[model samples]
Target chain A: MLKNRTKIKVKGLNQERAINNLSKTIRIYNFSRKEHNISEFEVDYNNSKHIKKMLEGQGLEVVSLKSRGPAFFIRDFFKRGGLIAGVIFVLIFYILQYSFILKIEVWGGEASQCNLVKNFIEDNLDSKLKHNISTEELEILVRNNFDFVSSVSVAFVGQSIVVNLNPSLLPDEMGTGFSPLVSEYDGMITEINLIQGTLNCSVGDIVQKGDVLVYPYVTDSSGKVYEVEPKADITAQVWLSGQEIHYDYRILTYRTGKSKVQSQVLLGGLVIYSKTPDILFEDYECEVYTKQLTKNLLLPFKLKKTIYYEIETEEIIEPFEEVKEEIISKARQKALIFSDKNDIIIDEKYTLSEGGGCHIVDYVVTVSKNIGG
Target chain B: MFNFFNEIKNKASGIDYNLLNEYNIINLSGKLLYVEGHQGVTIINSDMVAFKIKKGRVVVEGKELVLSELTSNTLLLQGVIIKVEIF
Candidate 1:
C-alpha cells in the first residue's frame, strides 16, 4: 500500500550507504525544494525509526514526513481552501458573539440620559434568552425592569437579540382646568385676542397678577350662539418687564496673508486621511470645498473642507452703554419667540451697574394689555 | 582537445554542468601538459568512463586515460573521475 507513497528528501546522507542499509525492495526517492533537501523511501514499518536515525546520523534535517492523504488534497488545502476556511470560522465566531448582545447603540436620546439608561438597563435587566422566555415575556421583563420605560421590544437582530425600550410619556399639556395659555411668570399682558372666548379686559388696561385677559365662553352674531362646552376660565400672559444681566465679550479678527499646507489620506470609503500637505493661496478670505466618498457601497460620506485663511484675531472692548442697548435688542427678540406675542411696551428701562470682573447690562420693561386689572 | 571533452561528455549519462564543474584533479602523474584556453589541447581514449574537475583542474581518476587539450583555463582528459577533492 505504501509503495507509491510521496517521497521525502533525506539530506546529508550518501546514496550508496543509504541504499545498502535499506532492504533491496525499498526504493529511495529524492526531491528538492528551495527550502529543504529530502530523500524518501518506502520501508517496512519496523525500519521507520532506523531510517530516521540513519538520516540524523548523517546530519540530514528531516523537516516533515507526509504519508497519509492524497497529494492533491494537501496541495489544495494550502492554496485556496485555507483562506476560505479561516473566513468561515471567523464569521461563525462573530455570529455567536452577536447572539449575545455584545454591543447596543441607542439613538433618539440625549447624551447624558442615554448613558444613564444604558447603565440602568445593563445593571438591572437579565439580558439572556432563557428557554421559557418568549418575545412577550422579554418585553414584560424589560418594562418591569426599568421605572422610566413605558414599552419595550425584544427582537433577534442577526445572531444576537436586542431590547429597545421606549420611555414613559410626559403629562398632558392641557392640564386640569380649561385649556388656557397662561403666563409662565408674573408679567403684564401683551396683546390679546378673543379667538374662542370672551374678552375679560380691553386693550391698554393695567391688570394685576392672575387677571384673566380672555374668557373661554363666547356669544355668536345671530344672538343664538351655543354655550361653549369649555368653561369660562380666562388665561393670559402678562408682558412683564424683566431685568437680565448679560455679558458680551467682543472678539475682533485681523486677516493674515500667510498660509500653511498639510497632507491627507483616505481609505475604504472613509477619508481617514487628515494630513494636508500643501498650502494654496487665494484672494478670498474664506474657502469651502466639498468632497464626497461613497461609504458602505450606498450612502455617501461627506467631507466638508473649510480652509481658514491665516487671520490674527484682536479683542475689541466696548463701553457699558453701547453693549447694553445691543443686549436689550437681543432680549426682545428672545421674548417675542417665547411669548408668541408681539405687543411689547417698555414700562421701565435702566442699567443697574457694571465692571466688577463681570461684564453685564441689566434692564426692565413693562407691557400694557386689555385684561382684568 | 575540443573533441576529447566532447567525446567524454557524450559517453557519460546524466553528466550535467553542475557535476562537471565540481570535478577535481587528484593526479596529473602521467602526462606533462600546458594549460591554455579552450581547444589548445585534446585527449583521445576509449577505456575511460568519466571525468571530474579537482582544485580547478581535470583529474583522470578512472582506470586508464588519454590527454589532449592543455590550457591554463580548460583541459581535456579522457577518463572517469572516480573521486574529487578541493585542496
Candidate 2:
C-alpha cells in the first residue's frame, strides 16, 4: 500500500503551515515524514503533479515529487522499449543456456587426441543437462580410452562442459598406438591372462624386472604389423626382503624417589589455570593425562595432571647366547610387518649373524603379486 | 490507576467518552503517541510538539519527536514520548 502511494516534499520557511495548506486542499491525505524544515506526505496519483506546481506557485521550493503507481508506467512505456527488450532477451538466453551443457571443451592435449575424444563423447552422450551427466565418469572414460592420457578433468564452465586434458608425450599425432606391458618386479611368471596383447612368457617362466611380457604390435598370418595399445593381466612370484637388527644390550632408565604432580585446568586446549610449583629436579620426564571435568557440551574443560618423574640412567649388558632366540624372534616380527598385505606369502628364509653386542637378521619373503604394469 | 483517574476527571469535566472519537490520545509504552480530533499542529520539534485540541492545547515532550501521520482531524506522533500535558 505504501509503495503504490505518491510521495512529495516541499521546502519553505514554515513547513508546518505548508502542511496545513496542503491538507486543506487535499483533505484526505496523511503526512509521513518531516526533517530539516521539509515536510513529506503521500497524495493520490492524480493530484501529485498539480500539487507540485501549486506548491511552486506559492513560493515554496518543491524539493522532490515522486509519483509511483500503475498510471506512470502506462504513460511512459514506449520510451523504454529498447532497453526493456534487451534485458528480456538476456534473461531468456541465460535461462536456456546455463541449464544444459553447450559443448565439450578440451583445455590441453594433442589436437588429434582431443578431436578423437570430442568425437567419442559426442557420439556417446546420454544427456546434455549438467546434473544428468557426471564429470568424474567422463574423466575416467577418457582416461581409459587412451593409454597415453596422463590426466583429464571434466567440469561445467558457464554453459559448456569443459574437458581439460593433459595427454602424455607420444611419438606423433597418429600416436605410437600401442604400449608394451613390462614386469615391474623380478619374479617368475605364475599366471598370464592375455586380454589384448601378444604374450611373450608362459606360466613358470622366470623373468627379471623390466622384461617385456607383452609386445606393442601384433603380426597377423599375412605378416602385416598392426599397432594396438596393449592390455593384459599377469601375476608373478615376487621375492621381497626386509632386514632388521636387534641389540643384546640396552641402556635402561629408572625413576628416582623424587616426583611432583601438578594439576591444571584446560579450557578448549588452553591452560586456564595451573598450580604453581616450578620443576625442582635437574633431569626429569613428564607424563601427562587429562580428565573431562565439564558435563555441559558448550563448556569444553579438562583437568590435566602432569607427573614429573626424576630419572637416572644406567647401561646394562648381557651375553649374546642368553637372548639368542628372543632377538631372532623380534627381528622376524619386525621384518614381517614390512611385507605387503596383498602379496600371497609362499615361503620365507632368514640369515642370522652376530656383531658388536647385537644380533643382525635378514629375512627374505616370497609372494605372488600382479607385477606387470 | 492513571487511566481510571483520567476517566473520572473526564466524566467530571462533562466530556463525551465515545462521541466521534474526538480529543483522544493513545500512548504506547511511552514510545508512540496517537492523537485524534486534532485541530492543527501548533508547534513541532525534536523535543516537543503542541497541537490545538477542542478545549485547550495539548503539548507532547520527548526525545527525537516525529509526527508520523497527519490528517485534517487526526495525527500520529512517534518517538520517545516522555510526557503529555493539557493546557
Candidate 3:
C-alpha cells in the first residue's frame, strides 16, 4: 500500500559503523546523525522491517520505527469507519435541524386576533417548505395583510418563530369625535382653561367622578346649541388612597449552607449515567441545568447537572414601627402610579391598624393634577 | 621572476580576474564557511571534509562535522571548523 513508506531510527554507541554497514547492504536513501550516537534513515516500509532485523543482528539497536504516508491514513480510516461515520452524522443532523422551523409564537394581540394571525401564518407556510420562508418576508406579509395591525415584527429564536403585533388606534380613541371631558377622579377643580367647549365646573368647585368638566354642547347668546369636540386643561386637587398589609410575624425559608451536586448524561430523555444514589433532604430545592449539543437539533444526548440545596424554615418577628413604615412607603408608591409627573402632592397621611399579627396601613395622598380624561 | 611566471600562467590559462575570484571562500566569524565553484567531495568524516576545486583541493577540518546540505554542484558543511587548507 502507498501508506507503507516510513522511517526508522537506528541508535547505538557507534552509529557511524552501523551506517557504513547498512549503506553497503542496502541503499541508504537519506540519513542524518544526531549527537554522534543516534541516526535516522528514511527507507521503504517493507525494507524498514528487514533493516531493523538486520541492524539488531549486527548488535545495533533500532530505537523506533514508524510508518508515514497517505496510504496509512486511508487504511486507518477504513479500519475505523464507525467512529468517523458517527461524527459526520451528528454534524449533518445538527445543521438540518436548525434549517427548519419547529415552533411559531404570536404575542401582543387579543386571543381571537392572535389565533387568526396564527392561522394565517400556518396557511401561508403550509404550502411551502419551512426553510424556504424568510423572517423578513413573513413580517412584511403579516403587516400588509392585517390592516388593524399598526406595527408587526418577526424574529427567529432557535427553531421558534416569534411574531409581535401592535394594534392600531381606533378613531374615537384618537380624540376626533365630539365628546365631553369628564373628571376621572373626585376632586376640587382648582383651574380650568377651556379651549373649545363650555366649562361646566368652575374653579374651586368640587366635582365627583364622571362629572363633566367640559361640555361639548355650547349654547350661544341666541340660544343656538353647537356641538364640538371638548378640549380643555382642567387641573384639580385629587385625594388618592392606597392600602397595604405588613406581617409582624413571618415564616422564612433559607438555605442551610449544605448542597449536593449530581451529574448525569441523558440520551433521548433517558438517563445513561448518574452517580447519585438518592436524595436525603426532606426539605430541599433542586435546580436542574442541562447542556445539549444544539438548541434546534434537539439531539438525543445531553448533559444534565442538578444542584440540591437543603433549606430550613424559621419564624421571624418584625418590629411594628419598621413594618408600618415599609407598608406606608409601598402605599405611597402605589398612589404615585395614578398621578402624573407634573402633579404636586399637597398632603399625605398614613393610618395604621394592628390585627392578626399584621399591621394594615392605609395611606391617603392629596395631589394637584389634570383630572380630565 | 614572479612577473615572468604570472605572465606565462595568465597566458596559458587565459584567466581573468573574475574567473580567478570564482574559487572564493567566505568565512563568517569562523562559524560558517561558504565556498563557491566547488567540484566534488573527496572524503567525508566526523572531523573533516575535503572537496575538489579547479586548481587543487580544499580540505575543511572540524569537530562533529556534518554535511547540512548537498547539491549537484554545491555543498554546505556545519560544525566547529578548526582548519581549512588548500593544496
Two-way DockQ contest, 1 vs 3, winner: 3
**Per-candidate TM-score, first chain only?**
0.29, 0.34, 0.37
Lowest summed lDDT over 10 consecutive residues: which window, candidate 2 chain B? Answer: B13-22
Where does candidate 1 stray beyond 4 Å?
A: A1-237, A240-292, A295-306, A317-346, A369-373, B1-87
Is 1 or 2 the stronger prediction by TM-score? 2
DockQ-based CAPRI category assigned to the predicted complex of candidate 3: incorrect
Predicted structure with the largest TM-score when compared to the true one? 3
Provide the global lDDT of candidate 1 against the true structure.
0.47
Task: Kindly list the per-residue Cα lDDT of model 3 for residues A1-373, writing each as its tens digit.
Answer: 4535657777776555554455444545445554356766666676676887788977778888888778778777778979789878999998888777887899999988888888899888853335677878888889778856888998877887889999876444233347788999999989888877788889999999999888786667867565667878989999988888788789999999888889998888889888784778889998999998456565667889999999999999887786666678998887677777888999989888888888888888999998876
Q: For residues A53-94, what per-residue lDDT tens digits would candidate 1 score against the true structure?
A: 665665666655555335545556678876878988999987
**TM-scores of all candidate predictions against the true structure:** 0.25, 0.29, 0.31
Q: Report lDDT (Cα) of residue B62, candidate 2.
A: 90
Q: Per DockQ, what order, best first? A: 3, 2, 1
What lDDT tens digits, residue by residue, belong to model 2 across residues A1-373? 4335567777776554555455445532445336555766667776675787777766689888777666666556656888779888999988877889777877787788778888888877899877788888998888877766778888888877788888776543224646688988888998988866678899999998889999877667967565666667899888776666666678888999798999999999899999957888888998999999979789889999999989988888876677767766666676567456787989988898877777777777788888866
Once model 3 is optimally superposed onto the true structure by TM-score, how far is the C-alpha of residue A331 displaced, in angstroms?
A: 2.6
